[model samples]
Target chain A: MRRLILLLPLVLFLGVAVFLYRGLFMDPSELPSALIDKPFPAFSLPAVEGDRTLTQRDIIGQPALVNVWATWCVACRVEHPVLNKLAEAGVRIYGVNYKDDNASARKWLAEFHDPYQLNIEDARGSLGLDLGVYGAPETFLIDKDGIIRHKFVGVIDERVWREKLAPLYQALVDEVTP
Target chain B: MKRFAAALLLGLAALGVAHAAIDTFEFASEADRQRYRTLVEELRCPKCQNQNIADSDAPIAMDLRAQVYAKLEEGQSDAQIIDYLVSRYGDFVLYKPPVTARTLLLWYGPGALLLGGFVLLGVIVLRRRRARGEVDVGLSQDEQDRLASLLNPTPSDKKD
Candidate 1:
């Protein structure tokens, strides 16, 4: 017992050291979305490419990716081609033009081939706010019922899609179709 | 050069003032304004992470500040506003996280450690005092005789 007592400080030091060591590699920016498994927030906003309004109901029938993006965010430009590639392979993607000018958004979509099936023009970021969007290039995986399943923050390159998002997306698609 | 430097400083100060003035809102009362200020200061910016929404210049932070002001004007209580943000952003938005099962150790760990330290100190002190008490008992017979001899030496020892 006395020997164990003498080792107590060393044990505590090791425990704390191990905990802090693990914390050093953890990404602080990756905030878990509070809306996972919850239905997407309701919104009635204009489409970027057309005069018609887009809403949560329009996205409810399919398993899709709701990608929050803006023209001002440089990372979105980096992630755009990958998104285009994914869309070519028939991945349903909906874009939220978060806090961006509609004209600029339209120009960007035109300049760089558009990947989104429908783009929600959230010029004031009201829908973004409702979705708890803090930054651009955040992609959310939604199930067929418009329920958010997972959220990936920052730029999604090809590897991230294949390794992390693809499996989840495929699972949701299979569950809905089968 | 000095004049130019002074002009640049003045320009910068004016810019700062303009930035601060951009979010001005019409409050129904002074109390509501105060509440709004407090709420913004307490709510952490989800984008910037460390800064409160009031201090951050991030667009999301600005939106949150506007939301806080709107909610306050709509007569939402402080708790209601906090709940609304927490529901969207989780407890990370609040500077003070509420006590929960996961946070139980974080809330009470330091106090428990301090209490344990005091208890260990008390035990060590008590043991030391007891050890010293044992040492303070009367000397053995042989040691007392040696002490007596040293204190009151015999006449022969004195002559030597």
Candidate 2:
């Protein structure tokens, strides 16, 4: 009886530990993709730069990055510098301007310094929902053959650039050279 | 003034009709009604913030309740509607997730830990018993005899 009483506390501790582990980490939403290894969703919109329209067909013949952002999304601002660096390295970037007015998008681009080769306005958020986007500031990497190779939700960081985008970019260059 | 009076009467009649509509949906059977209540209490209203359809005033919750009732009217079981909702919304919509291979550890972890503790307690208890059993106290035959006499209290021993 005395020993049982002593071990009760240890049993309770282990039981609680196992419970916390299951609760905290196990319930993230199932990552679903209709676009994985498939061609990018088709879209054409007025460019953030020139009067010409930018379409999905223009990006398909080469490896590219599609960044979804709005002027109101704070995380998009945080990720802008990393994108600018990617642009400086001559990475092809296309912007999917999400649910914002043309005036605001133009101002945000001017303020943050536009890194996109072509910007496509998705004003109604219909395109975003079709792409399974829950929130703003997501980046998708497409391979040279127009296949969506990767999806990064939320802000892009230097570590993500090094770990994720760099390897895929390198592989695309290798494929082209070989 | 006459137009205002007519509008007031019409508003009162509309209010009465709305009240009658609420009363018409009042459940008939005590047992069936209790089951319906239980289902709502357990099932989550997907569009509400941690609330069930029974408690939520959200339009989506009302629509969901209509769907549930339609299925019930078709003679579908409570479990069937719950299964349909789960299939559409994923397991996150379930207030109490089922105990499956994925949730095995979550459901039984507490019991397993308690059992493990009892095992440790048993081992400690057995070890203590053996340790206590090993100690021997030396007593001479005379001392034993006197001690036995004191405990037994024979007639002569009782006289003292």
Candidate 3:
């Protein structure tokens, strides 16, 4: 019994250590968001083209999609097609080009099809910081009231669109139309 | 040849002293020196994830240290300096992130687990104790009576 008492803490300590090490590698996004249902952060930046700039106002009065991307980010390349589909489906996408140089971003857009309605050049990443972006290629779904309804990190595939985005889009449209 | 060698030795000695002084000498003001030391400890060496700026031999860490000293000379407080770096770089710049809702699980999870483990152990121990029933450390009533009789017998009983 005395030996068991001595061994108990050591066993618990090892178990906890293992738990922590495993937890470190666990997908952080698996943890639910506290920012859900909150209003979208207000921001403005120069558009990818033309003299007009984009702001939070553009997303207001209509349901909108905000995609935070970077020229240097590899995942952004894969996810562009999904964004294009959303655009074709009449989703208004406001692009946040995070911390990339103008020349590279322009070159990238010229090569890959630009699907954004208005692209915000966040070369300094100030707006991305405000949006709590850890890495690029994250997407946010903003409602007509300017509240951020959902935040999606990583690549958005067709499955994600069918499962997650479609239901939310349908609900919001019904809310507005009805 | 000997004279030339002596002069070369003297030159090398002077250079060594200068280098040593640059590396080791602290400022006259204790506060400045202490602040400088603390800043070096606090600053993360991005290239060397496990090491602080002072401990890292990486070139980028050296450059960051130079920048830190430059800013310190310009009269930025510790908080101001940290905030400036955090703004430029992300939270990765800080060796330790601030404890917030996002990091509460990280900060307190271990402590909670330890407390839970203790409670579990206590329950198990108490259960074992109840199962055993309290051990009678002293003699029972019948044993005590037998012991008393054995210790002090009557005179007639002793003859038998």
Candidate 4:
């Protein structure tokens, strides 16, 4: 109808408005992970401040958090307290000290309150690259079966921990040996 | 001021040392090397969003390039290598999206829209012709000849 043809521009405008509204609500920084439901990538890394090496096996046998951080990353400092709180509550937090000088990483952790069970020295970022890590302060949720359950990019805070991760963790976290 | 300049020089020197980027690969043949170039240009950089792996200097781009090189050396086919990355990084990593159930609309929607437009235009013209009880598809040969005469009468044959 002629009337329908006249109304086409309005209909298109409304459709575009709705699409732009939805776009405004989307998190531009959040990238959908492709490592979900896959086993954690294997790597052997030495301690950040010690001589012993820890492998992928060390992270399994418990539902744990693996945080990739660096001294160069300012956001890692922002999420330090949240990580410390989680660690204090008996959540075993693993660390991948990504591409930072060994002494600097050790010093930063010491000053910021070390929350990790044992930090891995990824000085060359080899393990970080294997895990598809491009930026720092990326956290991964690993189940007792050694599978990567969730990967969160950017700083993990209390709200993010509760809203995005906790419900999934409660459902997927496997039995841990005491 | 002297101290500041000295520190700046030191920092620049440190950066130069830190970022001595050396991206090298040994290909089995010229054909394989060409394929490697094509594949990198086609693969999207996850961190850089808009850049292909070949053009991006993002750390993820570097990692992807290294992975591609390693896969090539391991004698893996390009498809297998791409599949391996897709399994980890999703189809978003590929610049050329696959035609799947999810991407069916993306692949064909524009073409369908163009066809629909053509059909609609044809229908509108036909309906207008039918409504007038006459068709004006185009001017007939005789009508065209008449139009030409009317626009420019013969020079000598024109009425005085």
Candidate 5:
């Protein structure tokens, strides 16, 4: 008992060291979305390119990636090619043109081949606010029922898509299709 | 010169106060304005993790501040406004997280650790004292005399 008591401080030190070591690799910017496992928020926003208004109902009946992107966010530009590739490979992608000018957003889509099936224009960021978007280039995986399954913050390169998002997305697609 | 410096310092201080008031919303009452200020200061900016919404210039923070002002003007209670943000942003937005099952350890861990430390120290001290008392009682008269002689080292003993 006395020997065990003498080792108590060492045990406590090791526990704290392990905790801090794990924390060092953890990304502080990757905040867990409150919307996960919940239905997507309702919105009545216009499309980026057309006059038709887009709503939550339009995004239902299929599993899709609702990607929040803006012309101002440089990371979105970096992530765009991967998104385009994903779309080419038959992935359903929807875009939230967050807080961006419609002209610029339309121009960007034209200049770089548009990857999204429908781009929701969040001009005043009201829809983005409803979705709890703090920054651009965030992606939410929504199932066929419009339930948000996962949220990934920051730029999604091919590696991120392959390693992290692809399995979850495939699972969602399989669940609905199969 | 001193008076001029003092006036300049006062002007700079006034400027600092003006900078903190980032928005000019028309509040119906002074109470509402105060509530808005408190809410912004207490809410953390999601983009800039360390800064409160009031102190951050991030666009999201600005939007949140506007949302708070709108909610306040609409006569929503403070709890309702906070709940609205918490629902979207989670409990991370609040500077003071509510006590829940997940956060019980965070709220009480330090106090528990300190209490345990004190108890452990008390036990160690009590055991040490008791051990000393036992040693004192265990010594025979002959052993006490020998210990005293070794400690004192009388003249005859030193000569040997």
Candidate 6:
């Protein structure tokens, strides 16, 4: 019993150490959003340059990728080509221009080739807050019923889009299309 | 004259600090303003480095502050507002985390460790006391003398 008591701390410390070691390999940025499986938060914002507005209506009733981005976000610029490819592949992608200068955002899209079907100008980032966007270049996968399925923080490159997002998007499409 | 220069510099520095402060919003009532204050201080800014929304200058924090005010105006309770944020941002947004199965260890581990330390200390102290009581249970001087005499039984004493 005395030996067991003395070994208790070593056992507990080893357990904690194992967990910490495992955590070191995990991505700190991949924080799971609470919005997953929950209805997409309601937001209303003006179109980038159009007189029309984008609201919850644009989000619900379809499987779509809402990419929260800004002209100042380098990762968004990095992911621009992949997003363009996704657009060509018939993926419905909407851009939420979060907390950016409108003119700069427009210029970025023009220079990089616009990939978004419609850009929602969240100049004040009110919509981004509703969507729980921590920073630019966060992508949200919304299901057909307007429920947010997944959120990917950081750049959505070919690898991330293929491995992480595409399979989930495919599942949503299969369920909704049929 | 030097004192005047110092005062002017101090005033200028104070002005700069004031100018650097974030915009303060007004609420409908004192209660609303108080709630807003409490909410922002309790909510964590996800992008900032260990900063609450009230202290962080991050754009996300600004948006969260606006949302808090808007929700207050919409007649939401403080809990509802916080819950709304938690629903969107996960428990990471909360300063006071809820008691959930996942966080039970984080909340109770300290208490368990303290208790264990106390138990161990008590065991060591108790064992030390027992050891002290058992040792130098040496013979008294009278007892020692009596023992010595009995062991070396003099010739006169050996006759009996």
lDDT of each: 0.92, 0.74, 0.76, 0.86, 0.94, 0.86
Worst 10 residues of 1 chain B by lDDT: B15-24
> Residue A108: error of model 3 in Å?
2.7
Question: What clash pairs does model 2 have?
Answer: none
Candidate 4: what's its TM-score on chain B?
0.69
- Of models 2 and 5, which has the larger lDDT? 5
Lowest summed-lDDT stretch of 10 residues in model 3 chain A? A27-36
Q: Is candidate 1 or candidate 4 better by lDDT?
A: 1
* Candidate 1 lDDT, A31-129, residue by residue in tens: 878888899999999999879988899999899999999999999999999999999999999999999998899999999999999999999999988
Best by lDDT: 5
Winner on DockQ between 4 and 5 is: 5
lDDT by residue (tens digit), candidate 5, A1-178 = 9799799889999999999999999999888888999999999999998789999999998999999999999999999999999999999999999999888998999999999999999999999998899999899999999999999999999899999999999999999878
When sorted by lDDT, best at the front, the candidate numbers are 5, 1, 6, 4, 3, 2
Q: Which digits, one per residue and each the tens of the lDDT, describe model 4 over residues A65-156?
A: 89999988899999999999989988888999998998888789888889999899998888886676768889988888889888999989
Q: Interface Cα RMSD per model, in Å?
A: 0.7, 6.5, 7.8, 1.9, 0.5, 1.4
What share of the reference contacts survives in each candidate? 0.62, 0.00, 0.00, 0.46, 0.73, 0.81
Model 1 C-alpha lDDT per residue in residues B1-160, reported as the tens digit of each score: 9999999999999989755725679999989988988898889999998988888999888899999998988889999999989888888898988999988999999999999999999999999999998886898899999999999999977863
DockQ of 1: 0.63
Lowest summed lDDT window (length 10), candidate 2 chain A: A26-35
What is the TM-score of candidate 5? 0.88
For candidate 3, lDDT tens digit of each residue in A11-120?
A: 97998899899999987443233356878767778876777777878768877778999888899999988888888888788788987888888888888878887788
Question: Scoring each candidate complex against the real one, what DockQ results?
Answer: 0.63, 0.05, 0.06, 0.38, 0.68, 0.57
Q: Judge the docking of candidate 1 as incorrect, acceptable, medium or high.
A: medium
Name the docking class for model 5.
medium
Over 4 Å off in model 1, which ranges? B1-23, B137-160
Q: Per-model TM-score of chain A alone? A: 0.97, 0.80, 0.80, 0.89, 0.99, 0.90
Error of 6 at B9 (Å): 14
B37-60, model 3: which lDDT tens digit per residue? 788787766555667777777654
